[model samples]
Target: MIVRAVVEGRAVDADARFALEARYGHFTAMQVRDRRTRGLAHHLDRLAAANLEVFGAALDRAAVLGSIRAVLGDDLRDAGVRVYVVEHDGRPRVVATAAPPTEVSARPQRVTAVAYQRYLPHIKKAAGFAQAHIRRAAGPLGFDEALLTTGDGLISEGAITNVGCLSGGRLLWPDAPMLHGTAMRLLEDLDVPQERRPLRVADLPGFDLVFLCNSHGVVAVGEVDGVPLRQDAETLARLLAFYDALPWDPLD
Candidate 1:
């Protein structure tokens, strides 16, 4: 069972965490093995590079919890699954079970195989080269992180989290080829300014601030190399407060 619990305010407990695997209704074990073998390494590499510490393979909460119940029966509480829960505004918001944080370099803009094809030989090869080039480009630029995308002007999300930018005091995200993440939808409902349009790299310099948002947490603008992002304390506080008040329902 995949347990979907609210992570209230960055609270993480190491003893209650567990991992999960999804059960597809019809696929045979052999089929599953075949699929898993195909792109497993690439997927794992991406997840690892993104600094995702805790991860589970459940499709949803019910599945996660059910698996726990099956394994431990009434003794589930003592299972030591290392669940990480965060709550905001007295409500649970994010949950995960995984390792502690990992370091992410700040430097050349993160590029992706999807985005680098125009400049590289093949998309598959481009994906492999993205990290190396980003590392090289960002080092001289004095930045610690670079984000990659599909180059179709679709800034979907970041290698690690969803992207949020401030343009004329309006919050915006790329419109196409990106997942409408739960947090992204919530922010939109709060009437935080949103722009569902193509996002260009050249446009980054025009934004007041740039941030990465996700179910796990939100990090404020610190530094994009030498670029000083506009940090509006009041705006951030209000936005966070708004998030804190939202229902845990991802669909809402």
Candidate 2:
């Protein structure tokens, strides 16, 4: 249950009216459920506690960033935990907690978790659930990475990174319910291509090329498995240029 809140004037608005967003990397989905049931503040406290144990300080950025992923796996249902990164000074800074979305319907969609082949068996089930989706989807397309979306209209990156694809030579991304990742922000100014419409899985094969993007950087799809992907070196270069322009302080 990672919570992000904005702090404006004298009011702490979790709605992000101010300029703050907090992400609490919980160890389990059960913990998220607990926080969802109890309250956002309680969830923040638990995440802060976990950060202190791993980093020994409340604002220890490295400890919080590095350990949150591992910690979330210990008790969470899936390897991945909810994360929230907010924009500040044209860059993203991690705040370790956030308020839940208000529009959560009574019947929320269930997030499925799957294991990957790159981690320890015990940890694989919990460590690579998100990544597994990437592998599974890419396996058939011969694509190493790709963007993920739900039937309802949520867009997120791949298991480990964000995704950007060229459609009709226009760059595009999903509108909401997707992680507002760092790399995605940096590319906002680029002229590669930008779209915010709902994209269907059936429409993937129509793309010219697909690439994965993240804080670690971007990687063009070499091979997904059996399917062959058209790789444009020029497009790949532009994507890398956007990646290199990121303000990677490592501390944030």
Candidate 3:
């Protein structure tokens, strides 16, 4: 099923454009089971924080969850749930949608680096034109995703998902401003050893095990800029098992 929003009163056309001065607002995606989601608090907090930054007001978590449940119902299991807190006519509004669950396999992917960085590093907003531009340009050449890097030759993250290098059982992240993924937060809370430091494009070929992670799960990188990576099957397995065991919280 696709994410169908339960639109109410006035019945504005779905194609209605954003108000003249409306800016890109916050959004979040989660996997729903039995009308519940994982990392629920973190997702909500993401919306709250972004709402404050973009709309200059606090997000109504309870009302937002209610809007989500209105669309999800009480028995939706294994669905792709999305929450959008957008600015309409200069005011913030909550909109939720749901679709059939889609999972990116743990299969290794081949990625290449691109020189770019996101506009809002801290807020998970609906601005992804740069990412889409890079992905479109790279996808045709048989690459899974584009790794965004800074002009100073520092690696940041991939087009959409976050990337990390595994070294001696510790996850090494780039020491730059970027979106802190909910998945990474969960992994850190799991006591997984991690460190943040500057990563250069020149070091991409030397990483023993580099993987991509987002809300779906973790997957290894088979190749980087035509260089084959040494896959770590054990680490991937452990991540999948641990992520699958995370508890789910109800929308209420």
Cα error, candidate 3, residue 184 (Å) = 1.0
What CA RMSD would candidate 3 show? Answer: 2.8
lDDT (C-alpha) at residue 205 in model 2: 45
Displacement of the residue 23 alpha carbon in candidate 3, Å = 5.3
Instruction: List per-candidate RMSD values in Å.
Output: 14.0, 16.3, 2.8
Per-residue lDDT of 51-120 in model 3, one digit per residue for the tens? 8888899888878777677767656666887677776655676766667987877668989888888887
Instruction: Give the TM-score (vs. native) of candidate 1.
Output: 0.47
Question: In model 2, what is the error at residue 228, expressed in angstroms?
Answer: 1.8
User: lDDT tens string, model 1, 118-237?
Assistant: 232111111224546655766565554454556554455554345777766688777545433335555777675567777765566577666665444455545443545565677667
Off by over 4 Å in 2: 1-156, 223-225, 250-252
Weakest 10 consecutive residues of candidate 3 by summed lDDT: 8-17
In order, the Cα lDDT scores of the candidates are 0.41, 0.42, 0.75
Taking all chains together, the TM-score of candidate 2 against the true structure is: 0.43
Q: Write the per-residue lDDT of candidate 2 for residues 179-243, one digit (tens) a residue.
A: 44445556776765577766544444467766665433456554332344566777766666665
How many residue pairs clash in each candidate at the backbone level?
39, 25, 0
Worst 10 residues of 1 by lDDT: 23-32
